[model samples]
Target: MNPPAEPPSRAALQAAASQRLHPLSWLFLLLAQLRAFALPLLVLLFGGGRREDGIADLIGLLAAGLLALTAVWRYFTYHYGFLGQALVIRSGLLQRNLRLVPFDRVQNVTVHQNLLHRLFGVASVRLESAGGLGQAEAQMDVLRLDQARALEALVRQGAQRARAAAAASGEGPEAATPAEPAPVLWLHLPMRELVRLGLISNRGMLVVAALFAALSQAGDAVMKPLGNQLYAGLKEGESWAASLHLGPLAYGLASLLLLLGLLALVRALSVALAIVQFHDFRLLAGERELSVERGLLSRVRAHLPKRRVQAYTLHESLLHRWFGRRSLSVDRAALETGNEAAALRELVPLATPEAMDGMLQRLLPEGSWPPRHWQPLHPRAWRRVAFPGLLATLAASGLLVAWKGLPGLWLLLLLPLVVLRARIWARYSAWSLEGGVISVRQGWLDRHWRFAEVRKLHALELRQSPFDRRHGMASLHLDSLGAHPMAPPLRIPYLPVAEAVRLAAALRAGMPRDAGVSRARTAA
Candidate 1:
């Protein structure tokens, strides 16, 4: 009998399966390069005024040609394939770099398809790992949409297998068995909720502010003329109103109406923006992963391994309260350095409090929201919170007395408001440590709740200011991987020094032994 054919070698299998990006990847790559250099090219083309140099035009053409050539070269050189449980990528034309990323290490896989990509039936794929240091570990600029989905599935299966193997070896948590249930549709935002989300967000104001800043920086030639026109128009309007002999009350009523109209416009813009950004939003919870798909013009599908979640935050703004909605977001350990628009940040953009509770229960069965008991801050914490405002008010009153005499003392009326704010904050601000999780609640007008599993804690800090020392108080701050930079910090301030130390010790002890939670003691 002929000898049994030997199993194919790993190298042979990998070489056989290695694949290049879509044939049109070069075009997409060229477009990306041009987009990056668009501003400079526009300046080079237009900054020359009416007198354009042939040399400059020729140089621009050469640069475009070079970019196209580079894109083509890169498309031909880059190759990716699966080698056992790892994804292997070979890239770089000159240096010839090889990178191997184990499936178990991938924290997130994102597939993005903008309007152009959708038209071409292609998408960009990004793999983010914890060790990427705020960068994507692997990125494929353009791939057939079907191929991208296939790759995502391969990674998911490979990661599941890795987890099973690790569990069998007693090195990781228990893996999901075949009996695990199907993925649950946790949340789906319809047009109504999307509208509510838009109404709750202040994105229109942010957009207007950004536009104003950009206009202000458009050089004196542009902004000076624009500002003069605006001023002259305002003067003309004022003269017109004066000619109408409108009383102060009528003028006030007109101003209020104008303000209301402007606010209505802003809200309309926000609603439109929200609809565009989060159209067809869906969140699905699988056995060990959470998947979110959203966007209208730029469709995005992102997968987050449930194990990588570091913390959770709930936001309730005044508008959200008015709409009976709250937003929930989670911080993941994945270090993502790609387009923020495509990031999987907001888990639930708008949900009723009851709906949010259900989500929290499903997401964290072992943990609870609005913990049974919250440890109140030191009773005198309000005094500390209000001291600065009180001092500022008194100083301003003094300054006013020095300048405008008795009229300056009118500012002293702000003191009551400042102290009332502090009292309200003290009443609401509290922390809770229970069931291996730490939760903090703060704010009066715009309430926020931040919580995280103890095992995910990265660092603990105890800070004491001179005033704190005098009052025998301390502040405990918690740090976790992938905490949102813009989110309110997970800090518990104005705790008795002894209680703070005890809580810190408890947190440190609860942290996983292998996590190596760091502790810092500082005086502020």
Candidate 2:
């Protein structure tokens, strides 16, 4: 065998003096400081009836002013500074804190920008480290957007150099294959497809956003009426605006309705905004890295190494089905924290399953990709699906009949049929594991066929409750490296024991044999 070469020395970069906070941000901070100082003093003065008291007012103002000044001073002195090898942040007042994050230890880096950030030409950079607790685990806050990109480029260069140096020193054996030249792949969803995806997701995020906006407006309306009524004698009588505000219960309902309409309008606005944000969105494929840059006012940039990807997934929502569009996800095992949850590295409508497969094959190491031919669930799986639903319905019906009387009995008749249909639907949705990938087909209303790379699975579980064992069936749960605190592992019930073992073996084979890698390959 050829002798491994020594790794190269890593490079380092440094940031300039801390930039001043945005003018708006500075104003907001001042106002917040003032409020914090004044609120307590006002409360104390009113509660103690000490306004007429000697020197109290003067003392309070002095204290408040001093506190605000201190805060401003702290802000300026403890700003963020970047070094090529590590991120440096200094914070605190009396007891200061200085943190240095090495580039090699960094699991991931993300750049986030909002409308304000875009307008101000600033960005927030979040750095995730595997070693830390609670808030200390992830470092984040705003930075100048241009400066952020520069820092990221520095980090990337440093990391590459470190890897090369490690290889040169024979400290890293995997240096057989140097990082590939960054591949250039562009991805997008057409307007029609985008619309379809937006609708199908029924994700309700847009709706929820609209609802919140409407509710806030309604609350403002309600409060305005009350305020008008309370100050009526002091000023003029209530006007139309006041009557339409918070006064009576009837007015509240009207306000709610009006708010609802406003919310609907907001939802539409949000959807329109989303379309604009993601419009002409593109993900460029780099040799060893993936770069995601999207949105209008808020531009986001994420850098991911293909080698670090533990898994890949393709998902389709109802709208995705109608428009034949799919969302592609790549999971980086090293950064299996909340930061990685929202499908870290998402690509919208890259291509079809076959096309995605081709992409995966190109991106992944040879022999690690999953087989495409997945076996669907046995036809008998339908019985398992239907029987439980039926039983639950019957039990519910029996209780209703016993407690509420005859009308409940009618529910009993529909229960069995509903369950049976549900079972058939479940059965129709089939899945199989090929190579290092697991494919699942599921749906009753809007069907989806999802594919996940086996290596991405954080854990593989073979479970058989008493009932399952009796039926000679088992369940396989596959957990991905996502950041969701409550993300449930994907479960494929009604699988045979032998089949589950085979799947486990594949996952183990695909996982990298590195101590630095998480122990996700093991089967349980």
Candidate with top lDDT is: 1
Model 1: lDDT equals 0.85
lDDT by residue (317-396, candidate 2, tens digit) is 55455655566665454544332234354544345556665666776556534444556664466777777777888898
What's model 1's lDDT at 267? 95
For each candidate, give its TM-score against the true structure.
Answer: 0.92, 0.69
User: Where does candidate 1 clash, by residue pair?
Assistant: none
lDDT of each: 0.85, 0.59
lDDT of 1 at 498: 92
Question: Residue 295 error for model 1, in Å?
Answer: 0.5
Q: List per-candidate RMSD values in Å.
A: 3.7, 8.2
Global local distance difference test of model 2: 0.59
lDDT of 1 by residue, 150-225 (tens): 9988887787788777776677789645444677888899999989988889679988999999898778868988
